[model samples]
Target: MKVSAKLFIVGSNSSSSTRNAVDMACSVLGVAQLDSVIIASPPIEDGVNLSLEHLQPYWEELENLVQSKKIVAIGTSDLDKTQLEQLYQWAQVKPNSNQVNLASCCVMPPDLTAFAKQFDIQLLTHNDPKELLSEASFQEALQESIPDIQAHEWVPLWLLRYSVIVKSRGIIKSKGYILQAKRRGS
Candidate 1:
């Protein structure tokens, strides 16, 4: 049976990222407790890499929400077999699912498929990449719509997945985009 409500939130991470999540949810949709959270940190960033060490804290926070009955499930995004395996072995709550970006390599990686089967973790797909929007690219798009806004100074902060359970309003139901900004050229 459906428990209270299931709120799915997917986003990139940083030191105070989880706090950003709660604030965004509360501000936009009044969501107090999130259900399923999909971690969307790109598997590779510059020289940074995905390791059990990097992912543990995020999963642990999700796990805390699950244990506290604030959330029901937790998931990952774009992680491959080796990475998924390491996370599965180490995570206290164990990821309920792993999302594969269809654009990353088209067909799901064979090894990832095999691993998901063995573990019973659902393998899902998404079109959005970790860099869903880039600084320059978003600015370019915005320039066409609103010329006065300084595209150069604006930077995308985070993206979240939230569903408005209330059907009464029946319009512009759900989504998340909270941007953090910093000036360039100090």
Candidate 2:
């Protein structure tokens, strides 16, 4: 069996969310360690706009999980060559892979391809939207599900997506999403 998870850090606030997401995923999947965890951060500007300062803490948190044996490998989503290079140079646990959004780029940039090849980093493709879940959409879902006025004040902080697979059979056994939210004022 193998378990893979993806953490989407919503908005600009992802301080401790990475660790919390991984811990919650581990608990939910009944596993001590996830086979892989890919982080998808909110888009800042464009391919050149990924901020290292903002990403450093999240990467550090994942590195801690790696050191503690809570995660086997960690990767990132939608980073260009410059951004990936900056992250790779600074990260304690270098990214093992990077996911490119095919919806945005029909062909992978040559520089990014060369860098990945040089570093032996796997280049994967995905079709996830730039914003996986928006605050307004989250509030709408909350209102629909809870039918409470207070649902409007809640803000989604992050989303964790997990998939458990039967490795031997190459089939998915289970998959689900876990969302974390907070009140507007708090």
Candidate 3:
């Protein structure tokens, strides 16, 4: 099967630097054509940070955009079950599995991990090693110990919201045909 590359940017802050990083990465990685970009509101803070409640206001607009377009990237630091459920309900899409993608530096709580598994989501971890290993035996052992990976079955709707925000802000470009096709499919 052909796998369309869909990038999910979780825990993204709304700072200029954060936005720029995502934009730059999307451009360099050529992620604009693959799927949607989702941006969750930053968490609330004492005049210091963006909070989830702060993001709630934009939820409707974000949802509209996702429904209109078909991208699937989202930015949010809050990944708790309650929030996840709310997002799923808002997007009107049921998550097939609780699987989540783990990129380098993204830390997840053990309880959350267990919760995700209970929901039937597999945790996929990807690490980019920059250094060459000197021990071939150790490398072989590591390779033998790693298990095979599989894709999750469900796509969350809140992810759709995040994807729309990313597209609206021009962090990523939307694919016209794919968006149209997705809308029709829905």
Candidate 4:
């Protein structure tokens, strides 16, 4: 299956980490060979905080990336309603299969999910850097928690997204596995 995966790397402080996350997300979405990534630096250029002015450059790239009919996974921190709206506008161009991979600390603005729903975009949230771990306890915890969770809740997406981040960060301490996306019309 040819799954289109889009990864937005927000607050990527280093080139190496950013590259690894992109590579891992691509693998998870079953499109590693395709390399469809969108790197969104935090709105703040020199710090962790968000500054709208700083995101202009990223906006251009984001607009271009979402033009495809592939699934997009955004790896970002918290965003307000306005920022989320901007993202929705960009992703709406193609619609259908889109995933927003965000940090655990970054709660989905009330309207982000609603906005995405309009286009059938799946808003996926992930763990912050501190939560990326491959320990047995972590796996066990996830196994126990996922079933009871609702899609609107953040845990499900957080775990899945974190796994990709862990692999990309080279912190998994094991060989990585690729996630294949189901192909279109399959």
Kindly list the per-residue Cα lDDT of model 2 for residues 38-145, writing each as its tens digit. Answer: 998654655565688867888999999999999999999888999899999998899999999999799999999999999989999999887889889998988988
lDDT for 88 in candidate 2 is 95
Best candidate (score: TM-score): 2
RMSD of model 4, in Å? Answer: 14.3
Comparison by lDDT, 1 against 4, better one: 1
Taking all chains together, each candidate's TM-score versus the true structure is 0.70, 0.93, 0.34, 0.38
Model 2 steric clash pairs: none
Q: Candidate order by TM-score, highest to lowest? A: 2, 1, 4, 3
Which candidate has the highest lDDT of all? 2
Clashes of each: 0, 0, 24, 4
Measured on C-alpha atoms, candidate 1 has an lDDT of 0.64
Whole-model Cα lDDT of every candidate shown, in order: 0.64, 0.89, 0.37, 0.40
- Prediction 1 TM-score vs. true: 0.70
TM-score of 3: 0.34
**Models ranked on lDDT:** 2, 1, 4, 3
Q: Which 10 consecutive positions of candidate 2 have the poorest summed lDDT?
A: 41-50
The deviation in Å at residue 142 for candidate 1 is 6.3
lDDT (tens digit, per residue) of candidate 1 on 1-186: 111221222223353555455455555555556656676653346677777777676667667767875566778877889989999998888887888877787788888988899889999887874566666776787777789887777655554555544345545445545554444542
